[model samples]
Target: MAPEPEEKDGEFVSTGSVLRQVLFGLVVAFSTLMTGFTSAWPVVLPKLQENPRSFNVTDQDVAWLVSVQGIVGMCTSLLSGHMVEYFGPRKLLLINLFPTFGLWLLMAFTSFLSVLYLCRIGLCISTYIIKSFFQAYIAELCQAKIRGAIAALPELIISVGVLVIYILANFFSYEVVTALCAVPFLPLFFLAIFLPESPYWLMRRNRTDDVKASLQRLRGQRENVNNEVKVLTRTSKVQVSAWSQIHELRKRENILPILLVLSILSLREISGQTALFSYSVYMFRQAGVEMDAFLCTVLLGCVRVVTTIIAVPALDRAGRRPFLIGSSVICGTSQLVIGFTLLMEIPGASWVPLAGLLIYVAAFGLGQAGIPWILMGELLPTPVRSIGSSIITFTYCLLMFIVNYIFFWLLANIRLGGTLCLFAFANVILVIIAYFWLPETKGRSLENLEVAFVKRKRLDQNDHDSNHEVTIELPLS
Candidate 1:
C-alpha cells in the first residue's frame, strides 16, 4: 500500500476538491439508504402477524422473512469482494440494484410472504455487495484527514432511510411503501453512471489515462493530481494472490486488526439493537406503554438520525478510539438503566427505555457505528482488502441473522430486562477490551496505521528481551 499522504489531514481541508469527493461518496452511499429501510421493514412484520388476512401470512411465515435476509446477506458478502475487484465497484453497484428494484416490484404488486422473503433477500444481498465497494471506495477516494466524516456517511443515510420507511409505513399500505423504497434506485444508479470509478481500480487495470482523469475530477482541476497518481500506480501492481492474503493473517499486524474488526462487528450486530428497532412497537406494547407504537418508532428513527449527524464531525476531530469506548460505556449504562427501570417496575418511568435508548444510539452513532467500517478498509492491505472485507461483512451478516432470529426467545426465556442487562455488561467488557486493542485511525493514513501496529509489536518484543536479560543476570548473581 502507498505511504500516508504527506499533508496528513490536508486532503480536503486545504483543497477545493473535497466537494467532488463528498458528492461521489453521497452517490455511492445511497445504498445504505436501502439498507436502512430493509432494517426498518422488520418493524412492519409484527403488524403483518397481527392482521394476517390483509397479507395472507402466518406468524411462522413472518418470522422467516427476517432471518432469510441475513442468511442471503451472509452469502452475498462473501462474494462481494471478488465481484467488486473484478467487475469494478461502479458496475457492481449499478447491477446489484437491479435485484433490489425487482424485489420491490414484487412487493408492490403482491403480498405473499414469499415475496417479502425475496424482497428482503434482494435488499440484503445488494446491500452487502454495495457495502464492500463503498468501504473500498471511501478509503481510496478521500484523504485520511477527512475519511472519518465520509465513512460515517452511511450511518446518517441509514437513519434517514429508516425514518422515511417508518413514517411511510404508518400512512401507506405495504405495497405503496415498498414501491417508495424501490423508486430511489432508478435515479441513484443512473447518477452513478456519470461518477468517476475508483482511481485505484483504474490504476490496477493499468488504465493510466482514466486514473489521471479520475484524479483530476476528485482532487480538482487546479490541484496537483500527479503525486496521488504515483501512489495508486505503486500500490495496485501485480495483485497479491489469495494464498498470500491467507498467509498475511499469520502476521501480528494482519491478525490483530481482523480480530478487532470481528469483535466490533459481532458486538454491534448481536447486541439486539436490530431487535430493539424491529420490535420497538411490540416491546412498548408488552411493557404497557400508552402512546402509539408507530409514533414511538418514528421517534426512535429521528433519534438515530440526529445522533449520527453529531458523530460525523467528531469522527475526524476527536479520533476513533474514544468514540468506541465512550459509546460503549454510554450504551452499556443506558442498557443498565433500562434493565433496572423495567425490573423495578418504576412508576411513571415508561419513558425510561426511550431515554436510555436515545443516549445509547447517540453514543453508538458518535463512535462504534462508523469506526469498525473505517478500520475494515484501513487495517487490511490492498492485496488482502477484498477478502478481509468479505470475511468481516459475512460474519457481520451471519451474526445479525442469528441475533434477529433468537432475540425474542432470549426476551421470553430470560426476560427483557435480563437480556438487555447482558448486552449492557457486554458493552462494558468491550469498552475495556477496545481501549487496549483498538488503534486510533482518525486523520491517519491507512498505511501508517498498519505500520503503527508493527512498530508497537517490535517495541513490545524488545522490552521482553530486556526483561529476560535482567532475569538471567539475577540468576548469575
Candidate 2:
C-alpha cells in the first residue's frame, strides 16, 4: 500500500518536525506518570501498614488496593475510547484528569482509607484512558522511523513516576506521599486543555482546514505534509457502535491483527511486571532478603527507569520480535530460578530472589514492557483503532486485575516460589508464540503495515491452506 512509503538505505524514514513531535510526546507522557502512581502503593504501603490511623490492613488488603484500580479501569477503558471518538483525544485527557485532581485533593484533606480507595479508582479511570489515548494518538500521528522510540516514551515516563514515588516514600508519611502525587496532576490537567487533538481523528470528521493546520504545526511550515495528510484522509473510520466492536472481530478484515494483539497484550500482563513491582516489597520480604524492603524496592524502581531508557533506541533498530523473544527467555529463567530457591528455602542466598527480580525487571523494561504496545499501535487501522485499542486495553487491565487479585492467594496456596514458577512457565510459552506468530513492524509506516496485513489476511481467506503465511520474516540483522 502506498508503495511502502519511501525509505532511505533500508531504514525507516521519518519526516515530522522534531521539536513539535517531541513536545507533543513529552506532554502526553504525563498520563503514564499518573498510571504509575496508581500502581506505586507497594512502595508506600510498608509505612501505611504501620500507621494506626491508616486503617488496619493485611497483605491481602494491600493486594486488593493495587488490583481494584484494574477493576475500575477494565470497566471504563472501552467507554473512554468512545469518548475519544465523540469528543476527540485532547478533550478525553481533560475529562479523564478531573476525577483524579478532585479526588486526590479531597484525600489530602482527610485520612480516611475509604477516601483513598475512591481516589485510587478515580485515577485508574484516567490511567486506563490515558493508556488508550497515547496508543491512539501516536498511532495516528507519529512518523514510522521514530515510532518505536516514541511509543516507548510513555512507558519510560511511567517508570520515572514509580521512581519518584519510591524516592518520596523514603521520607514522607502516607498522607504526604498521596498529596505529593496529586500536585503534578494540577499542571498536567492544564496542559491537556491546550494540546492539539489527533489530526487523523479530525480528518475522520471531515474537518479539512483543521487537519491542514494541525499537520502544518506538527510537521513544520516549510516541510511538505500534503501527501501524509491525504494518506490519513483515505483511511477508514469505524461505522459500528462501540458495543458491536466484538462483532467486527469476526470479519476477515479484523480477525488476525486483533488476535495477535490480544495474545501479546495478555501475555504482557502475565509476564509479571505488575506482580513483581507493584508488590515488590512483599515478594522481596518473602525471599527473606536481609536488606530493607523499601531500599530494595527503590533499587528496583531505579533499575526499571534505567533499563526503559536503554530500550527506546533498541526497539527501533533491533526490531520488536527479537527483543520480545530474547527478553522473554531471560525473564523466564530468572523467575524460574528465583521460584526454585524460595520454594526450597535455600539458606543464606536471600540474595537469590532479589538478584532474579532485578534481572527480571531489567529484561522486562528492555522489551516486554514497551514493544507490545508499539505493535498494538502499528497493527490496528484508523477506522477501528479506538475500539480496537479499547478491546486491547480492557484486556490489559482485566488480565492485570486477575494477576493482582490472585497474586497473594497464589502465594499463600502455592508459596512464593511456586507462584513465580507459574509466571516463568507462562513466559516460556510466550516466546514460542512470539516467534511463530508475531510480525515485525519495524521499518514500516502505520499505513504500509495495515495494508500488508490486510492483504495477507485476504490471501489466507482465498487459499485456506497458506499456513506458512501466518508469521512474517524479519530483517536478518
Candidate 3:
C-alpha cells in the first residue's frame, strides 16, 4: 500500500471538517439550550410576579428564586473545572443534562418556594459545570487558528436559544415554555451518547489507542494524530495537579497575561451586560412599556439574537481588541444617553431608553458576550491552560454574582438612569484597560501567542536594563 499522505505543514485547518463541525454544532446546541433556559426566567418573571401566591411566594421571595441560581452558578465555577478535568467533559456534560432537564420539569409543577429555590440552584450548578467544561473542551479540540470562531459557536447558540424561548414564551403558557426549553436537551443527550471522549483527556491518561481514535474522529485523518497526541501528552505531564499548576502560574513572568485575562473577565461583568439580561423585563417596564413584560423581554432577546448573527462572520475579521474597544464605546455611550434621558425625564424618553438598551445589547453581543472565553483559551500556555482557565472563570463567575446581586439592589433604590450611568462608567474604564493591556490575538496561533508573551516580557526587561545602564553611566560621569 502507498504510504499515508503526510500532514501539511503550516496549513490552515478547516474548522468545518464534516465530523468536527457536526460535533461542535451539537455541543453548541446543548450550550445554547442551557443558556436559553437560564435566561428564559426574564420572560417568565412577570407571570411569577403577578401570581406569586400561585407558587406560594411573595414577589421578594420569587426574586430570590432567580437570584439564587446566579449565586449557585458563581460558587460552583471553580469546582466545575476540577470536576471536568477529573471526569472528562463528555461525562460531566451528560451528568449535567439530568438536572438541567429535571429542573425545568420541577419548575413546571412546583408550588413551593423552597422547591423552586432547590431546582434553580440545581440548574445553576449544572450550568456552571457544563459551561466550564464545554469551553475548555472546545479550546482543547479546535486548531489554534480557528479556535475563536469555534468558541463563538456557544454564544451564537445561546442567542438562538434566547430567541427561541422568547418566541415560545410569547405564545405559550409557562408550562409549555418549560417543556419546550427541555426539548433541546433530548437531542443533546442522544447525540452525546455516541460522541467520542475528548482526545486531550485521553492522551493525558495515556490511553494511546483511544486518543488516536478520538483524533481521527475529530480531525478526520490519522497522519497527524500521533503528533497531536505527543503535544497534549507533554502538556499534560507538566500539569500534574491543579494546585501545583496554579502556583506555577503565579510567577512574575505570567503576571501580564494573567492580569489581562482577569481584567477582561472582570470588566466583562462590571460592564453590566449580564445585569441587563437579568433585569431586562424590569428595565422595559420602567421605560413605560405598556405591553406584557414577557413580550417585551422576547423583543429584547430577538434583538440580541439578530445582532449576534450579524457579529459571527465579523468576529475573526474585525479582530478581538477592535471589537472590544468599539463595543465598549458604543455600550458606554448608550448607557450614558439612557441614564441622562431618565435623569432629565425627557419627553419620549421611553423610546430613548429603549433605543439605548438595544444598542447596549448589540454591543455586548458583538464583543463581551463571547470574547472573554475566547481570550481565556488563547492567553495561557498549554501546561497551565486548564488551571488558568478555571481561575479566569472563577473570577468571572464571582463578579457576575456580585454584579447581579448589587444590580437588583441598585434597581430598587437608584433611578434607572443612574443605574445605567454606573455601568457606562464601568465600560469606559474597560475601554481604557483594553487599549493599554489586551493584546490582539486574532489570526495568531496558540503557540505563537505563548512565544509572543515570552518575547514581550524579555523585550520589556531589555528596555529596563538599557535605561538602567544609561542612568548609571550619566551619574558616574
Separately for all candidates shown, the number of backbone clashes (residues 3 or more apart, or on different chains) is: 0, 0, 0
* Candidate 1 vs 3: which has more TM-score: 1
lDDT for position 374 in model 3: 73
Per-residue lDDT of candidate 2, residues 260-289 (tens digit):
778877876886668787778788787798
* lDDT (tens digit, per residue) of candidate 3 on 231-302: 455444445467766776766435557667788778768878788877787788886756666566666777
**Model 2 pairs in collision:** none
Model 1 error, position 55 (Å): 7.2
Point to the candidate with the largest lDDT: 2
Instruction: Tell me how far the alpha carbon of residue 133 in candidate 3 is from the true structure, in angstroms, after superposition.
Output: 2.8
Query: How would you encode candidate 1's per-residue C-alpha lDDT over 1-477 as one tens digit per residue?
Result: 112222243333545787878888778777678778777776565555555554576666767776777788788877777777787777887888766766777776665656666667767777768776687778877778667888888878888888888888777775677778888887887888877877877876678999999888887888887866765665564344456567766766556666767788788766666677777777777666677776776777787788889988888888777787888888888889998888888899887877777777777777777777877877666656777788888898787777777777887897778878877876876776676666566776653454444532233333321121111000100
Of candidates 3 and 2, the better by lDDT: 2
Q: Please provide TM-scores, in order, for all candidate models, with all chains considered together.
A: 0.87, 0.87, 0.85
In candidate 1, what residue range of length 10 has the lowest lDDT sum?
468-477
TM-score-better candidate, 2 vs 3: 2
- Candidate 3 structure lDDT: 0.68
